[model samples]
Target: MKPHKLPFENRWSNGEHGWQWHCELERLGLMNVRAMFADHETRHPGKRAVIFDIPGGFVRDWLAFHDRRTARQQFLWRAIVIGLTLVTAVGTVLNLLRL
Candidate 1:
């Protein structure tokens, strides 16, 4: 689905947090399909800042569904990673004992 765009740009000081906010907005179906930001001059004239389009809640249901799906996937991946780590640790210990 296409993302909805906001009329104005939202300014942020920290790029990482700004990007994360954009990602969350995209995940919530508020922004474009991709999270993007642009550099802009702040009201202070000389100060530079990053700006991202504010997201609109056009697809609330879709956003909710996506969030749930993402959460489930994240949980599954964490479980898999933990299980693999445990298996690897056990194998390493067994090999050490045999040697």
Candidate 2:
């Protein structure tokens, strides 16, 4: 299978179509994989094509980084929510005691 080509110039140009172009490229790669698998099946019986060869630590590291970032954001939001709730509860208690 030929390597997929990327539109580097357009991607780096800060254009809105960068994501659209990426999706198109992904679709094209999938189509190519289907075609390659079909050809492989005809030529070799009972064998599967290895379409992707990812490094061992890549996915794990990516997930760990994503989890850390997500946790940080969640902590920030939770702190803000808790602070607001505490303030509201305190205000209610003070108003009731004064009445």
Candidate 3:
């Protein structure tokens, strides 16, 4: 976990075929996972027919995007919780001094 590595960037290579082709995978770090799968169809030409038939690869990409989204949502929730706690603490002190 490098200091600058985003969470998804860290987990991106933990999946199948990820570690073996880490460089190529890293190139896709900024792309929406769906775009990567669509581009794969071009690189592997004949593989398209089978890929469209099953769509497992596309599903994997969606899952990655969804997981990343969920992580972001959790982070926001945590921030909100901390903010509310601080506000409550300040308000409590202010109320006590006025009494």
Candidate 4:
């Protein structure tokens, strides 16, 4: 893994249709990052990512903001898709009326 790659970046494993569903973590080298509350037993056996015990306040605030941002983006995309579909449906109905 490159030194600067984030946890959910290119290190993810490809699932069905090349979708990334999981990633692994390792305690490699002396680094600036820290892995807190890591279960070595589970890490080796399950090959799971090491848990990062981020502060509660950071998790609450950051995750809440991220969720809201993602929700807004999803809503925008859905609105665009629905608008296009409605336009297509109306056009089809108008064409049928002219037949």
Q: Which ten residues in a row have the lowest lDDT in candidate 1?
A: 33-42
State every prediction's TM-score relative to the real structure: 0.43, 0.46, 0.43, 0.45
After the best TM-score superposition of candidate 4, give how far the Cα of residue 73 lies from its true spot, in angstroms: 1.0
Cα error, residue 55 of model 3, in Å, equals: 4.1
Task: Name the lDDT of candidate 3.
Answer: 0.54
Off by over 4 Å in 3: 1-52
The residue-by-residue lDDT of candidate 1 on 1-99, one tens digit each, is: 444443223433235544455456556543443232212222322433222343322223334545677799999999999999999999999999999
Candidate 2, residues 6-65: lDDT per residue as tens digits?
333221323443334344435555456446545555675344322243221322233344
lDDT for 55 in candidate 4 is 33
Task: Give residue 16's error in model 1 in angstroms.
Answer: 40
Rank the models by lDDT, top first.
3, 2, 1, 4
List ranges where model 2 is wrong by over 4 Å: 1-51
Error of 3 at 66 (Å): 0.4
lDDT of 1 at 38: 18
Overall lDDT per candidate, in order of appearance: 0.49, 0.50, 0.54, 0.42
Q: Write the per-residue lDDT of candidate 3 for residues 26-90, one digit (tens) a residue.
A: 44553544575666566764563322342434435544756789799999999999999999999
Query: By summed lDDT, which 10 consecutive residues of candidate 3 come out lowest?
Result: 2-11
lDDT of 4 by residue, 2-74 (tens): 2332323232222331121112112331121222322333344343433343332322333344457679999
The parts of candidate 4 lying over 4 Å away from their true place are 1-54
Provide the lDDT at 34 for model 2.
Answer: 44
